[model samples]
Target: MKFSPLETPLRTIMTPGPVEVDPRVLRAMCTPILGQFDPAFTTIMNEVMEMLRQLFRTSNRWAYPVDGTSRAGIEALLCSIIEQGDKVLIPIYGRFGYLLTEICERYGAQVYTIECEWGNVFAPEEVIDEMKRVQPKIVAIVHGETSTGCMQPLEEIGRACREMDILLVVDAVATIGGTEVNADEWHFDGVIGGTQKCISVPSGMALITYNDRIEKVVLSRKKVERGIQTDSDRSILAAGKTIISNYFDLSQLQDYWGPRRLNHHTEATSMVYALREGLRIILEEGLTERFDRHRLHERALIAGIEAMGLSLFGEKKWKLPTVTCVNIPDGVDGESVRHMLLHEFGIEIASSFGPLHGKIWRIGTMGYSCRKENILKVLTSLEAVLVYHGVHVNKGEGVQEALKVYIEQSKAIGAGR
Candidate 1:
């Protein structure tokens, strides 16, 4: 028996998330470690928070990274704000929506859901109607549904929630840097994001932020626990019979990131480095330009795919630019095509989930992977794979159509400049 030092394969990641990380960020993660509370390390933490605020386009003082995956951030936000028997409404647009509902239910909150078809987003009017009927204390929705590659409309919904005096919690795990999301302007009460999606970093941390209104709710709660206080002097404690999971306590997390600097757990130091550098890249490129690049690449990919004779899965208006869902042609094994792309071409794409599984393939134009070259390569490889599966299509037409889209977009961007 023998073992070798671990090595990871290099593949062009076109999957929905955890996209190909930049080499610079990978190098940043390899730097020497430091004590979590060391001055240098704390300085790095401060920089990370500032970068995240810039990326999130929010002025909220509570912005910081949670010590686990994106779902951890979602749980922390929900478990903290949702008291026992509080009414929580989740609009189920995809699998992640159901996940939000489940997390709220675990906190003993009464979970109610308004469902939309898999490939569609809810209209603001529809959500307003639901809010009137449900009158929920909190309304949770996904800004970009990774499962179905659909972007839910948030601005109008946020305005409606504000008028109704209901808190809005958004899961922007897939949209944050890849699209336009203005937390403060949208009147979002709390928003959660992740590093792996648009930030182009390895996964381990989740960024969460809350406005002052939500802070007031946390302060008003009578529950108190023994922990360091946060900036608002709110105790990091939960009352009631059952203790919500201790590891995910937001109050304590807020304290640790705030002035107190209390120890919660050892932070993921390497991931922090990666996240900071990833965010630096975003700021360097300018968030709006990054977003426009994503849109341009997305349009090119869709134009190429459609030119290849495949129809997209979602409504055109609601399709997510970062992750596009395309219907698999009849008689084609979606999994086999994906396997062929990986093994034969070193490209990766994803299969849909649940009911959409085996019916569609998810192709992502995200982070460092979203580029003209990558778009052409994916379309060319996909054409080969599809033809091999007996789905006859023009071999070079997709790339040509994609090139045409790039030319038009280049002209448009030039004119704007």
Candidate 2:
């Protein structure tokens, strides 16, 4: 039997994650492979760290991408600092928040939680109040809950955590590159980001940054692997408590990324290239500009959806700009519409999870997929599909409203010029 060369359909992905990777990033991934520790490749690694620092808006000494999806970075950070029976506070507003709780529990943390309704985020006062009550060693929260398209405000929580001297860990996977994540000003001890969502890169890397406050805890749990231990390392080996997973150990991974250059697992070369290029694209456009772009597209998408007689699912103020949640119209099969969008239009949008699964459709205007062309495509296609399903929508109104947004922006730019 002979296997053919791999091929996949061309799709316009309008999902919460794994959105379209930028063409530039895809080209970068095709660059010839280099030895992971070669001077040239290491230079690229250092560049990636610096770029990650800029992307996260942090002055952190440690900024790098882990070799797995977004969850890997979250797990590494939690496992490194959380010892058995360490008290942890997780505020769950969506599915990813529960993911943090699960990771913490697996690492033997005694987890405490505060939860709000799925479509709403907790007030800063509520979270701060919980922190005072629970007084956990760490507070983990999601900056953007893509599952419900709610973005929790973090500044107040961060300030409160600092005042209480509890480490504040944030999962900013969905909001990092697409929105403002001031890691330092927000007082986050650590932040984990993903490549696939707003970074316009493939889904193989998880970016992380941590200030010295978290570093102190990670260093306290450091243990050097015996195989690669130098004489100096041998002296300090096992001096502190050892982290549970060797592969996910932040302490050991640091040495490999640090000047000591101790060998850990081989790095994922192509993904690093993709990440570097992705970061460069973001920096080239500028962070503020990129954020504005995401917001602009999101506004257009929302305008179109609302004009077509659809209702948005989450609170307007707390809604995530990258992922928009639209209510599934009454008497329409949400999944069938999605199927029509995919099979008939070659467009892919996501459905919600758990209670929201059939009640809402998640449309993502994220990363490279967040643009005028794709937003219009989704709006027009969705309107057509809804009409086919016998839903009464304002014919042509969806595209019309979306075009108004774009036209207004263009006029504003012209006036500025």
Candidate 3:
């Protein structure tokens, strides 16, 4: 059989994740590969670690990327810290929150959970109170729960965890580049971030940063593999408590990413290039300005959705700026609308999982996808699809309202200037 060159349809991705890759990042992926141990390649590795430290807003000595998607970092952090039957408290507010629980359970952790409604976030005090009651060794929570378009506040929780002497690990996958993720300031022991959503990179790397607190725990369980162990490594104590999975182990990974340069596995050459370029783009744009841009686009999107006579699905105060959840109109076929939007308009949006499956539609405005043109395109296309599906939307009002937001912002900026 013969095959032709690969071709894919162009799409305006507006989904919770895997949103859109920046052209620069895509171009970087095409750069020639270098051997893993080459001095030049190692320099790029060091650059990625430094850029990640800036992106995560941390001064931690340990910062690197896991080779898999965001979940790989989450797994590595959790499994490394958790021993047999250690108590872990995970607050369940959205689908991703439950993922923490699942990872912990699989690693033999005695996981405890507290719950709130899907579209609502728990007050900081609520989680603190539960933490006190559970008295768990670790507290794992999500910063932004894209599953329901809700963002949980972490400042107060982080402070409380510090006072209580509990390890605080956070899943900041959806919030990293689009908003503020202060790793050191928040007192997080470990935090995991993703590339697909707000980093404008492809979904192949998971950025992770850890403070000394987490490093102590991970090193205590360290075990170098026999295949790569040196004569000195044989003398090092294994303590018979090595981490469960070799591929997800952080102790050995640290040495590979660290100055020791001990071999773990061959690095993903193109993916590392993509990540370096992606992080560079973010820092060049300026974190504060980028966050404000996300907020500005979010406001425009919400204005348009409300003008179309559709209600948003979460607490307004806690809605994630990167993703917007809209209550599906009564009698409207949610999948049909999405299908038409994809096929006819060359656009893509996402649907929710579990209870929110058919009740709400998730639209993302993140990183490269968060722009005036893209926002207007999604709102306009969605309005057309909803009206065609017999959902009574105010004709032309969606685009008008969105345009009003953009116009007003421009005027405010001009006046300030």
Candidate 4:
């Protein structure tokens, strides 16, 4: 087959990330390109920062994008704040916990980790106990661990960090738009999130923030070379210990986005437009409503899956609203079912990593793809595929169970309770 113009099947993206992009975001990106420093473009950039502040529930002036993926934002925060031999405490609950430890070690931070089972989250007392013991300079954690479909509760942990004066950093990629991340209320020194997850934008950009506590550390560790320092140049460069990775340096990135507009790598114009529009759509929906939507769809999806006689894989209370992990019933080929869903139904679902692989299916009700129809479609297709594979399932039960949840919810709303 000759490779002509690129064309692919339209898939219902119900996987962990890179969900179906909002058509409005796509339309926003289609506008003509502008120079990175153009006044109008810079205005949009400013608006994005302010909007991200609202999304993060932060008043921190440093809130902005990392110009890369979610991990990039994590690295930016870690690299800028963590010095050689600075002790960093990380609690391992899932894959992203491992990622936090890996990144901190790479930056020469003395990494101390407390781990829990993959599907389980640490209690506030547990994390606080570790903090009291280690008294590390920073505590890094993942708010939502998509790999295990778990969300770690951070309210108490954040309060502990504030009282102890330990900087609290969170990777909120999986929870930012679809769930609550009270940066200010929770005393988050830094927060990182990807555009692709609940924000409904294409993968490529990251939204992140740093508070004054972290800003103090970053400025103290600053390393800069002044060529023509202006009154507007608030850049903290290579004056002290320089950040290892220049590309991921928060100082330079901050300077560029700051009053000075110091030259850095050219921003990805289209992604900025997409992110702006994505944030706009999220704000329009209202954060509480969007979070409730994710929760409602997740509940409905789980109801449908359970009605089909499949069990969930994790602790019930900690399940992430954006991702659901369904156990593969005995004698069922999890991969085969996923393949059928992809090839036959044109629906994408994810399998787990490491020990959980093949034991569970990770389904996402996130971003633009999280809808009543999408949930019904996948649950129905899954039942069909399961029954066809010789697993016993009642016909039409998945859709029926899911619709029941919607009806109950609507009636409750109607009753104004």
Candidate lDDT scores, in order, read 0.89, 0.92, 0.92, 0.90
Encode model 1's per-residue lDDT on 135-168: one tens digit a residue.
9999999999989999998999999999999999
Residues 345-396 of candidate 3 have per-residue lDDT tens digits of 9999999999999999999989999999999999999988887888888988
Error of 1 at 296 (Å): 0.8
Superposed on all Cα atoms, the candidates' RMSDs to the truth, in angstroms, are 3.3, 3.0, 2.9, 3.5
Q: What is the lDDT of residue 311 in candidate 3?
A: 98
Report the C-alpha displacement of residue 132, candidate 2, in angstroms: 0.9
Per-prediction TM-score to the true structure, in the order listed: 0.95, 0.96, 0.96, 0.95
Write down the lDDT that model 3 would get: 0.92
TM-score result, candidate 2: 0.96
Q: Model 2, range 1-417, lDDT digits (tens) per residue?
A: 999999999999999889999999999999999998899999999999999999999889999998899999999999999877888999999999989999999988999998889999999999898889888999999999999999999999999999999999999999999999999999999999999999989998899999999989887656344443577665544443346788889888888898888999999999999999999999999999999999999999999999998999989999999999999988789999999999999999999898898999999988999989999999999999998999999999999999999999999999999
Give me candidate 3's TM-score against the actual structure: 0.96
Q: What is the lDDT of residue 192 in candidate 1?
A: 96
On the 0 to 100 scale, the lDDT of residue 214 in model 2 is: 90
